[model samples]
Target: MQPASIDKQINNYLPQVTVNQKKAVLTVVKTFAEQDENEYSEEFKKELDSRYDEYINGGKLVSEQQAKKRIKKIINGKSK
Candidate 1:
């Protein structure tokens, strides 16, 4: 199908929703509160540890509340 035609059909299914409902839905969609311990491979763990070190040293670590606000801003199509 043509891109424009597909976009039009998708838009039909997604009517403009209220900001509150949109925020709630986006929160549920993006938030994964649990992790599977066995799913992490050694290489993935190494990469994650490296990035964690950089984030800590760069002073870019955020609290849970700050992280939520940043995520909400992203989902709402707004800048952080």
Candidate 2:
């Protein structure tokens, strides 16, 4: 009845399933997940659109090297 038990049961039967059966199961899971009723607010959508437009219109963007350096600093717990 628990999630872990269900996961273990599914894992046990996975090896016996064909590739097509696995694909079918994945499709069904995706369909079920896509049925979520959550909706973003209009203000949030507008903020996203504004940010996207700014990025498209040559807004200041970090270079790949800078991004990697920032990520490494965060991972190493070093403050700027």
Candidate 3:
């Protein structure tokens, strides 16, 4: 098998719990570290950066009205 597939299998086999019911946070960290980093495309990166910038700089939250409007647009098939 390929290295990535092998590593994923190994990661999946790791123990998920310990003695005191503490969550396996290290497993999440390790999985993130071992993840295929290049799966994100340039466009996806640009969109992620834009959303992160908006959240950090504008501190914007999605309003119910905006969500309703988006839903309406989606239901009408008007959103591309």
Candidate 4:
């Protein structure tokens, strides 16, 4: 589906959500809007999955909250 369609669906659901839910939904919308198709190709996903597995195998396992923090850190650490 098109980005506009996705945005419309998400916006339709956002108003009835809690504040935290709104923030999360907006963040998802922003990320989807920002991504480039080529930048998120299948090869890229496979490599990222491999890296995540390596991190896990290296004893870098974290709780859900910790994982979220580290994921943002890792994403921000990359040079876009």
Best by TM-score: 2
The C-alpha local distance difference test score for the whole of candidate 3 amounts to 0.76
lDDT of 1 by residue, 2-53 (tens): 9999879856755777778777866764564334433787899999999989
Query: What lDDT tens digits, residue by residue, belong to model 2 across residues 13-53?
Result: 99999999999999998887776546677898999999999
Question: In model 3, where do residues sit more than 4 Å from their true spots?
Answer: 1-38, 77-80
Alpha carbon lDDT of residue 56, candidate 4?
Answer: 77
1-80 in candidate 4: lDDT tens per residue?
99999879977887789999878877886888778533778888999999889997894566999989999999999956
Candidate lDDT (C-alpha), each? 0.76, 0.91, 0.76, 0.83
- True-vs-predicted CA distance for residue 63, candidate 4, Å: 49
Candidate 3 residue lDDT tens string, 23-43: 455667567877756378789
Q: Which residue pairs does candidate 4 place in steric collision? A: none
Candidate 4 C-alpha error for residue 72, in Å: 38
Positional deviation of 79 in candidate 3, in angstroms? 11
Candidate 2's error at 34, in angstroms?
1.0
The 10-residue segment with the lowest total lDDT in model 1? 29-38
The 10-residue segment with the lowest total lDDT in model 2: 32-41
Q: Write the candidate numbers in order of decreasing TM-score.
A: 2, 3, 1, 4
lDDT for model 2, on a 0 to 1 scale?
0.91
Give the clashing residue pairs of candidate 3, or none: none
